[model samples]
Target: RVIPAQAALFAHVWLDPQNPPRAIMLQYYRDGWMHRAVWGDYDVIPWGAANTTERVHQGELPALGEWTRLEVPVEQLGLNTGDALTGFALTQFGGHVAWDQVSIRGTSDPANDPLRSFAAWWRSVAGKDTPGLSGELADLAKRGPQAEASVEARRRLLNHYLINVCADTQRSLAQPKAELARLQAERTALEASIPSTFVYRDLDQPRDAFVMLRGAYDKPGEGVQPAVPAVLPPLTATGANGRATRLDLARWLVAPEHPLTARVTVNRFWQQVFGTGLVKTSYDFGSQGEMPSHPELLDWLAIEFQRSGWDVKQLMRLLVTSNAFQQTSQVSPELLARDPENRWYARGPRLRLDAEQIRDNALFVSGLINLTMGGKGVKPYQPENIWEPVGFAGSNTRFYTQDHGDALYRRSIYTFIKRTAPAPFLSNFDAPNREQFCTRRERSNTPLQALQLMNDVQHVEAARELAARMLREGGDSAESRIAWAYRLLLTREPAAEELAIVQAQLTAHTNRYAADLAAAQQLIGNGESKPDATLPADTLASYTLVANMLLNLDETLTRN
Candidate 1:
């Protein structure tokens, strides 16, 4: 079996009964090894012949949980005829891991091996032999339309493998931590050379760009000289040699003479904070989009942003620290009648948490969140068989493992995103398709979402874990536990009525499932299996059903 995560135990030994037995040898080889840290080459078995050693991916740093294959040559390990060959040992390693498939083969020729063949085909595509791909596609096309599509899909898969290999190789040669430190120091020196205060400067050189005909780089149109748009006044070129760089662009963007730039940016920022900008189309302030609802307020903010030297932190402090932002989201019928969308910012917006915030909040309440940032992406726990079409015929299968350690608990933004496959929980909550630029994501509610909250293994596990944490940290009383649960999950103490309601529910559950203590405990405890019981099966079932219902309530999902 493929060992999940970083390390595993592996070994092989041969038994030759005839003459003096030959010394045993075990060789570990990875198929299509993309990340160097995930596998090792020809290290002498640290433990003598037959024993298992903890085989780590070359470094302690975690992996991105890509599909990787490992192999142990059983025959080469020196086994005589009729000697038993124990498959290598693979132990649990931290972080999301996946094991493909394991095999023990007797052959010495790597060319005939299935995994080696698959790996070779992969590497061959990466190496770029168009004939192989074309031939396969042609054969597939002759079969039927579906076959042709399959061939094209395979080609895409091969292309992705090529990109990943190229990327991994480049990363391998890239600067390590020491090099990064040196680079940072160099950057600091460079910044010191330049003045921090914004200054007006002409571009050093003129820049020219060409429009792509039909948006294809292969079909370029005539070159267009850099100049302000025709609708705006002509730019007054300045300095010894006229040019247009970001400095010129920034100047033009906020120049007192420029009409749209400041207004657009200010409106966009306002939209970010208030959910709706003065102008509905923040990005497109063009004639086609929605007109500003409060043009004067937008202009005021724009002027402020420019006057403050574009210090975003200061602007945020001034805006959010104000009483207007602090107002509760509770909407009076009068306010709702006048502005159902809450356009005036008379009250805060009642919002559903973003995908990242939702996952982070879940882990935070479970006491399992790790406040780490900035590194290679880690794969979070996902359901089995989720990577079906992506790993279809001839491609390596991906197995997802639960991350039990620090890596599992990182902020959701840092998780790896695949265009073809995304983390299920986050996707349900409207995480974007990273294949394209996304300014805003849609918020949706559906039965599927409720099903996920109620039945998804991860959410269920998190709830149980949170319950156990409350039991441990709270005083030994129902009221205290109820209050603690609210504090961790909602960041506030439960209201008196809420506390009473939850306490009553807990008591009812406890008494009802008295004969099934094991099951009851499992329902409340983290990482514990739900126990099977004879007498209180129905009662245990009832309590669990109710607990799941509470977890699925609308209040649980909404941030407000």
Candidate 2:
């Protein structure tokens, strides 16, 4: 504490009965000289200076194990206002003692008149007039601290006064706070302006590793050295320190002699295109994993991948351009019965698109997808309050605010993902929760997936936009419009039967909407995109239903 003139130090201290302190010492600096004040029965050493002062207070020491008040005046310790109190030491001879509520205050009779003492202390500390403080103090003083209700009221007034004091302190600190915020923003900008990347750096001395017993960290069984698995090729590369480094491990992974790395890498890419890996268990390549369906083909592809210098684009081109990949997915019932999963390369890949692919496909066909390359994630429309149940009150994601304009139309890759409550449109299509690493996503067909495609605002808007495109670019006839939409969505001319079915539905919708113009307006206003003013509302709404039907078709959702 800083010394105050005519003030005394007060403390409540408890001394251990088994080991009471032999003495207590208060050391302070006065006029650039050190002085020590000793209490209790103990020897006082001059320490080659005349500044040492001793006071015998054996009678004042509290009874052992009982809390007692200890007071020392500044004058007795040769201290004046503004002098620095350097240190306070208890039981210098090694004893356990606890100190509490230590404070320095002027000599005021707090026991008899605490309200005035409290006001004085506030004035001394605050050093300025605070708004509402005087009224709160007066209200508290009037309560008198008597009955339980009065005590509660007085406590509330004190709390309110303290809150005001804190608010005043905050106001006083506003300039510094703004300066700190500006400095932090400047630091962040400086960091972002500098180009940086992470690189591995070896420590001067390698840390020793040990195998744990039963995987318990504390139960280390045996020391081990850096090496690859014994079943595969040994690690031959080493750093200048004659130890294997991360660089050496990296070189070993891509080395032609290594058997597993190239195979695993090729398998993962193959799985991305084929919907299943050759080994079935893409993440696990162990003894318990399924054997490769075509071992020779796997080896040949692995070698070819390594030979291409691991060019992913070249590998994708080779895979997609192969005869096996281009085969028709349709098969005879006998062939399907023999190989339901197509593990024998019996047919081309036929599977539903992933969640991101499904969303992006709709936007792409509707000409609403923003192809902007890099930025932070964007928020699109989702059901209201979906995140509230799973979100913490203090979390930034407690409220989901949908974005507008271009942000609403960015690619699905740039969609902001909240782990607790993922976008319902994506989750309903079996998107992973992202809580752990996923080598392969599980695909499931459910009614919710179809419902999302049919009713979601994004999809509905996409359909409306698609309908606008069909009306404007399609020939000026209903049959021509239906054929144009089928080609745009399915990438093929619709069969006569399929064309007739859609035309009939469009006619029925047009009749139904023509009778109810409000229904037509509501249907055309499903999305943020403005409807084309030139097109009739009933016509657009009729075509919107047709477009939604095409978007939800199995052929549109699957890659065959």
Candidate 3:
């Protein structure tokens, strides 16, 4: 009998096991040298079982004098297609186990063994070559599946395997037009036909248009139809109406040789990442627009982007990883004097995070940011009655009822936007009011922005929440708590100067809050979120003030 590793009693043997030892394993493997990946492990045996119990790991061999087979899935061992696999190992703790016809065999042929074939098929991207096993294997896999169906389906398609074939449906439905007509007639005679309402639906019909005079409802002008503008390139394709639709226009726009489309798209993407496009004016590439500084580089990028099937993410990766994108934005006095706009790209992008980011950062840093992406826009806490005077008659944008719980703390993008009163915090930070099509937001340095960051109810609440997190999660020392807050809010470690300033503020606020405990209570209990009652009122208020100072700093607002 083989003795298990009792030293590692109930050890999480995440690594490949040569012999079965009782342990619980999990996904997400990272051996320092290897890439962190979603790894599969052999099933966990019974917890803390000394003797080889009835509960065996998935690939465990049945203990007996007779020979037995153990099938170990390579994928489970975290190796994928085309990976170099070298050898295996055997371990016998009690004594040297007898080995006679011990051998490992793998084959390309599916018929040799069903279990091996199933594993091969599971890892592979393909339809089964064996017709008999195809349906049976798929059905059997349905009994107890671990992985996602879509994940497996994607693998099959990649390897040219058919996910499924409706052979029975095809055979049963086979019919010509005449056969179908006869069958329908027979069915009509046998069964009573349900009465249906007739209504006009879509058809290939000409839709005429009229030019309206003045924006009046009654005003109409000469009849017109779909026509391409004389200036731009002509549409390459159209429908039966001989009118170019949006789809046709879209198709032509992304066509390989389309000059403006790729250039325009790349330019916009460049602007977002680099804070300025090659052509300064992102919205326009007309004759009025600024000429590209690096025309050659822009063209090359556009061409490459087009070649990659207009892969936006790929293009973004290319831009962000480039040398030009990596430089520090710190400006020298000489360069500042010589190039006011920094058109030469002498430095990297140093931009103030726009309104949404400013508020979101406050929420995120404080550990109050709800990360549920893509849902109905919620009404977050706005200033008391800000929307009261801001609307039109018949507009349903009346109440400024604030959302409680998670909705109140959702990402700023999901904050409900009203036309008359756009989400104020973001709008104050130069986020567009949606009055017009703004390709690029114009930023204005104003006292209003600074004031909002400091005193806004949302921001104040975020500070308190952050203070709570720092109190709970931050380590023992004052320095550690301050450092934790700084790192959490800002992606980097705090500079000595920045750290000193925050530490000083924390000390000052701690003393101040201690002197006025009632004020501290009021300060920490500002918004919808509950106060962290476990924390002392003075400490909570002090941390809140420190967090507030951190959030308001120009360094915190700016994206490095």
Q: Give the number of the best model, judged by lDDT.
A: 2
Query: Tens-digit lDDT track for model 1 on 1-560?
Result: 22222223232222222321112222333332111112322243344322223222332222233333444333323333323223433322222333434444343233422133434434333434434345654344234323335655666644543433334433664557458779999999999988578775544554457898999988879897667888896676554456445556667776876787667776666666666777877657787888778778777877888788877887777777767667888888998999898777788856676778766776777666778767767776777777675755654444444555577677887787666778898788888866777666678977888787777765665665565555567667767866766665566787888777776777677676676767665554433344333324434344444445445656666745
Rank the candidate models, highest TM-score first: 2, 3, 1
At residue 494, what lDDT does model 3 achieve? 86
Every model's TM-score? 0.53, 0.66, 0.59
Q: Candidate 3, TM-score vs. the true structure?
A: 0.59
lDDT of candidate 1?
Answer: 0.57
Candidate 2 per-residue lDDT, tens place, 1-560, comes to 45645788667778899998765654444444354545554454332144333332333356779998777777665566655565654434457778777677874344322233444334333434544556655544444444234566667656654444344445766788789999999999999998799987988888889999999989998998778888888887577657888888999898899999889988998898899999999999998889999889899999999999999999999999998899989999999999999998889999899999999999999899999999989999888989888889898998888899999999988999998788887788888887878898899999889888999989999998899999999999988888898888777899999988988999899999999999999988987889998989999999999999999999999998
Question: Which residue runs does candidate 2 get wrong by more than 4 Å?
Answer: 1-185, 192-201
Clashing pairs in 1: 14-78, 14-79
Better of 1 and 3 by TM-score: 3
Residue 292, model 1: lDDT of 78
Cα-based lDDT at residue 52, candidate 1: 28
